[model samples]
Target: MNISRRALCGVALLAAVNPLGIHALASPSAPKIRVGVLKFGTVNWELDTIKHNKFDAANGIEVEVVYFAGEDATNVAMLAGDLDVIVSDWLWVSRQRSEGEDLTLAPYSTAVGAIMVKNVSPIRGIPDLVGKKIGVAGGSLDKSWLLIQGLARRDHGIDLGKEGDVVFGAPPLLSEKALSGELDAVLNFWHFCARLEANGFRRLIGADDAAKALGASGPVSALGYVFREKWADENPDAAMSFVKASAQAKKLLDESDAEWRRLAPVVRAEGGELEVLRDRYREGIPKRPLAEEERDAAKLYEILAELGGEKLVGEARQMAPGTFWAALKT
Candidate 1:
């Protein structure tokens, strides 16, 4: 499912109904948390689940979801206090913390990503990627791209950028290029990978594979819900309520295919594509929020440092303390 289309649908729906206006007229009995989200991202599904199921209302908070066109826009809004929370990666959380932003992360999903190729292609593993044209979804500094680069060097003795021709673009474009034979394989975000597989591509390796090779104790989710420290501090109960609602939605995704089906329109998936997406969501959902020590921020810093060098994380091999928002667990 191309997430952008679904995001547009969400925006259109929001515009038509004026959810914010409706919320304003409702009884001002509950606290409100304004959440920033992307129009065409996976976060939309989870947020929609929470809204439709009235999870936030059940938890005594009025959830207001604000939409953005891209990450930069969402980041700016969050920084400007226009949003109380947003879905983002740990790297961004770390970078923000390094700059003294006092943002914290709670696990959203652990399903990192995967590299995919045509089923008939002879590229059976990452090792076989040498000298091949590979498509990457994000930019050169994208965390998954860097992790794959690091893993290729550490586990396969290959520097993918120097040894293989890497082309970076949007996930949908990468998938199109790979399918058209312009690239041998593509490393894409999980949702894009699921869409490609539904269209006949095959997974060569997953980000979890790279993490395992990097010595993680278990699966580590790179994405999470990020919020300002001050906001969380002032509204601790509301923050926990948000986390609890999100966790409930995650559980529903993990346990019920019916829930996925129910969310099909929100995610823009149907039939076999819906099933593939459901399976991917199940595979990516984290079992729990990461503990402070369990986050392994140091190892991630090392991987980013190795692949992206000073350009990504500067001279640091460890992120600032309080990056993982461990209080959610407590």
Candidate 2:
């Protein structure tokens, strides 16, 4: 009573159309999640995962990544509804909210953005910056600048918020200007700070340090996990999933130095590297998001208020719209 060859072929054909069997073998891939990130520097970990498509397989997430060289470029894209998410300084979100841009802060992303000066220059500290020119990326709106500005006011009483006290110039020119001695120093993110330090620039206190000096009890240079508010409202589950996956990724990076070391070249490829750049990243990365709202963040809101961003104060009080943090439970 052997089965015929024709009968076996017929059974194979049926299996191809059988939903139960196909589903058991492999479920359909998870929907792709598009993420927008800064094009260069300390954002290496997220970029590496996106570049290698690592998260797609591990977390059942497909990421469509878009890169921008500066905050303005990213802000424009966010305004145009071109991005599903953005990872950047929370300061940008504060400014956007102040200006009435519709976006939601997902969670804390990173805890670092710094500024450095040349080692041999006369600019020994923030006090020396009194008459020296400085380069800043986003004029007065840049969060890094605002944090440092708040610091100068609090610590040194120089008040960089004023005109001609500290010059606002593009970031790219800072390195060249610092190297050639054309400029005294500059405010930059951590990765560039490493470069400036390696090229004989001295550490003039990072944004995190400045925040602490100004009496911030916890993390100061907080990076916000952000996206369009309308998008999050429409796709609550997807947004929740994104935040969950991002929290997982941040945890993985935090717990493993070997994994971080493996990612340095990827950072270098995305942008130029200076000595101990990876170290700078590791030093800055935090293990987890705050379980509750942070006082320091409220302090940041106050800083924005001083900067004439009253609307940011209102939005910071309601940073996370959805109660999705329950998903990040260990």
Candidate 3:
């Protein structure tokens, strides 16, 4: 779907307040950064932290949180100028740039999902998944699913999608099915995978490991902060401040268990599940240098292109230049 600067798309949603009291507008003195987040996305944990602790105010901006139901809604809200920023994959940014859109992405998280199986399941590797039911979240062309397919093809010459009985559904539903023994294995989002681990599921393989086998340098940022390039150029200070505040929020989350305790209900996890989510989230914080990340991202994009084909990448055979914001702090 080609989107011009003025034209946007849509999805519907309802809103709810997080435990942290939300400040919807900038104070009379501070510049505002309108951020659109999925109503229940993991990104909200950090956004909530930033707002609750006044990190944005400290960094010289106010972050006004807007809620969206899905990526399409966030993309639309962003293009319509209702939001200054949103979290999205760099591939989408690359495709938009290739199509002549002036957009860029800042690294967010490297938390790719994993392939999981029941603790007693016989599936030990990609090959063992043959003839078993595999539940996949994010549909057929899901990036993690595609990576596992690429790895399977590269290493064992089998297409799991064709060999296994594949089931696609929402993450929560799939997680439930996997737990109930209705599915023999699952490839799901990281948080869901982490939850499964807490519930006795063993990871068969991680997307990051599959990516490494296919030549990615290390953990790749599957999602990031995306925004119009013009906005960043015009409001350089606010842009930089948001980045700094985002980093500070991540540092805090990484260091303080008390903060996680505060965020527990927000993420809807507790006991072992909450611990798994916290540890996995902290481990996902992007640590690779930007240049190295960019290179690895480019490599991963090529592999993804081979696996997902044109429908996924939308006309770019390679990741476009300037796909990642060049000004990220080292």
lDDT of each: 0.78, 0.59, 0.85
TM-score of each: 0.89, 0.73, 0.91
Candidates in descending lDDT order: 3, 1, 2
Q: Name the lDDT of candidate 3.
A: 0.85
Better of 1 and 2 by lDDT: 1
What digit string (tens of lDDT, one per residue) describes model 3 on residues 146-182?
A: 9899899889999898999998999999999999999
Ranking by TM-score: 3, 1, 2
| Model 1 agreement with the true structure over 1-330: per-residue lDDT tens digits | 112324433433443366455343333576788989988888989988888866665555778998899999999998888899998877778878888788998888877778899988999988899989998887888877777778888877898988998888888888888888899999999888988899889999887777767766677777888998888777777787788778767877788787888898889988878899888888777774366335565576666777787778765667767778867566
Give candidate 3's error at residue 147 in angstroms: 0.8
How many residue pairs in model 1 have overlapping backbones?
2
After superposing candidate 1 on the true structure, give the runs of residues whose Cα lies further than 4 Å from its correct spot.
1-27
Deviation (Å) of 103 in candidate 2: 2.9
Better of 1 and 2 by TM-score: 1
